[model samples]
Target: MKTMIVIPARLASSRLSEKLLLRAAGKSILQHTYEAAKRAAITDSIIVAADDPRIVAEVDSFGGEARLTSVDCQSGTDRLAEIALMHSDVDLFVNVQGDEPEISPATIDAVARLLATRPDADIATAAFPILDESKLHDPACVKVVMGANDRAILFSRASVPHVRDGITPAHLQASPPIFWQHIGLYAYRRDFLLWFATQPAGRLEQLEKLEQLRAIEAGKTIVVTAIESSPPGIDTLEDFREFVARIENQ
Candidate 1:
C-alpha cells in the first residue's frame, strides 16, 4: 500500500500561540517535525497540510511540499481529510501533528506497519508503557486500555485498567505493562480517513475531547503498538524553552 505522512499545521494555537512557527535551534517547530517525519525508512512522501499561507510559505522556505487547507477544519484529522481528497492514489495516510517536533520516526513507521499487517484494524497508533506511578494518575497523561490482541478498548485522561485493589511497584515493573500512555501519532487507511471526516461528534469524544474516541464509538477497530516514550509536544513557552535547552546542550 502506498503510504504518506501529512502534518496538519495552523498558525493559531490557544496554548502556545503560533507555536509551530516558533524557532528553536534556528528552525521552526513545523520544520523540525517535518524533518523528523522524513526520517522514516518505510516511506519518503511527506507534506504539510497547512491552514495558512504563512505555514505554506514556511514549508516552501525549506523546500518541503505543502497544501493550504481550510482553517475551519474541525481537527487535524479533518485537515488530513482535505489532503486525502487531493491524493486519492495514497492508500495510507499518517497524521503527524505539527507541534510534535520530537515525534519518533520509528514510532511513525511502527504505526504504519501495524495498519499494514493487520487487516481487521481500521487505524493504528502508538503508546508507551506508563511505569511511573505519578504519571499513571496524572489526569493530563491520556491512557490506553487494550482489548483482545492489540485492539484498543478505550482512551481516557483518567487512570484506566483500573487496578481495583491497592497497587504496588511490582505491577509497574512487569514485562508488559498493565497501563499505557497514549501517543498522539496515528495511521489511517484511506477509506477510514474519509469515513472519519463524515462522522458526527461522539458523546464520549465530546466529554474527553479526544478525537480518536469518535472512531471507537463508531465501532472501528484500532490497534495500538508499544514504542519508546517520545518527548512531549511543544505546548507552552516552557516546553519551547526546554526544547531549546536540549538542542543547545547537544
Candidate 2:
C-alpha cells in the first residue's frame, strides 16, 4: 500500500506565537518535525501541508517538500483531507502534527501498521500509559480507554476508567494499564479522510473539543497502538525552552 506522511502547519499559533516557525538550535520547529518524519521508512513521501506562504517559504528554506492548502481549512485532519484528494493512488495518509518535532518514527510506523493489519479499523492512533496521578488528573493530558483487541472505546480529557473505589496508584500502572494517555499522532485511510472532512462534529466532540470523537460517533472503528511515550511538542514558551534544551544538550 502506498503511504505518505503530511505535516499540517500554520503561523497563527496563539500560544508561543508562531511556535512552528520558532527557531531552536538554528532550525525552525516545523523544519525539525519535517526532518523527524523523513526518518520513517514506511512512508513513500513526507509533505508539509502549510496554510500560509511564510510556512511554505520556511519549508523551502529547509529543502523539504510543502504544499499550500486553503486558509479556510479548519484543522490538521482537514489539511490531510485536502492532500488526499490530490493523491488518489495513496492508500494511507499519516497526520504528523507539525509541532511534534520529537515524534518517534517507530510510533508513526506502528500506527500505520495497525490500520493495515486490522481490517475492522478505518483509522489508527498511538497512546501510552500514564502512571503519574497528576498527569491522570491533568485535563491537558488526553486519555484513551481501550476495548477488546486494541480498539479504542473512547478518548477524553478526563481521567477515564475511574477507580471509583480509589485503589492505590500502583494499580493504574498494571501491565494493561488503567490510564492510557492519548497521543496526537494518527494514521487514516484515504477513504476515511474523505468521510471525516464531510461529517459534522458530534455532540461529544464539541463538548470535549476532541476532533477524533466525530469518527467514534459515526461508528467508525479506530485501533490504538501502545507506544513508549509521547514526544514533547511545543505549545508554550516553557515547552519551547525545554525543546531548546534538548537540542542544545544533544
lDDT of 2 at 80: 97
Local distance difference test, per candidate? 0.91, 0.91
lDDT of 2 by residue, 1-250 (tens): 8999999998898887888989999999998899989999789999999999999999999899999998889999999999999999999999999999898888999999888888789999999988888887888999999999999899999879788878585786687788899989889999999999988999999999999999998899999999878878899999999999989999
On the 0 to 100 scale, the lDDT of residue 148 in model 1 is 85
Which lDDT tens digits does candidate 1 get at residues 14-52? 878999999988899999999999999767599899888
Model 2 residue runs over 4 Å out of place are none
Deviation in Å, model 2, residue 91 alpha carbon: 0.2
| Residue 186 shift from truth in candidate 2, angstroms | 0.6
Provide the TM-score for each candidate, comma-separated: 0.97, 0.98
TM-score of 2: 0.98
| Pairs of colliding residues, candidate 2 | none
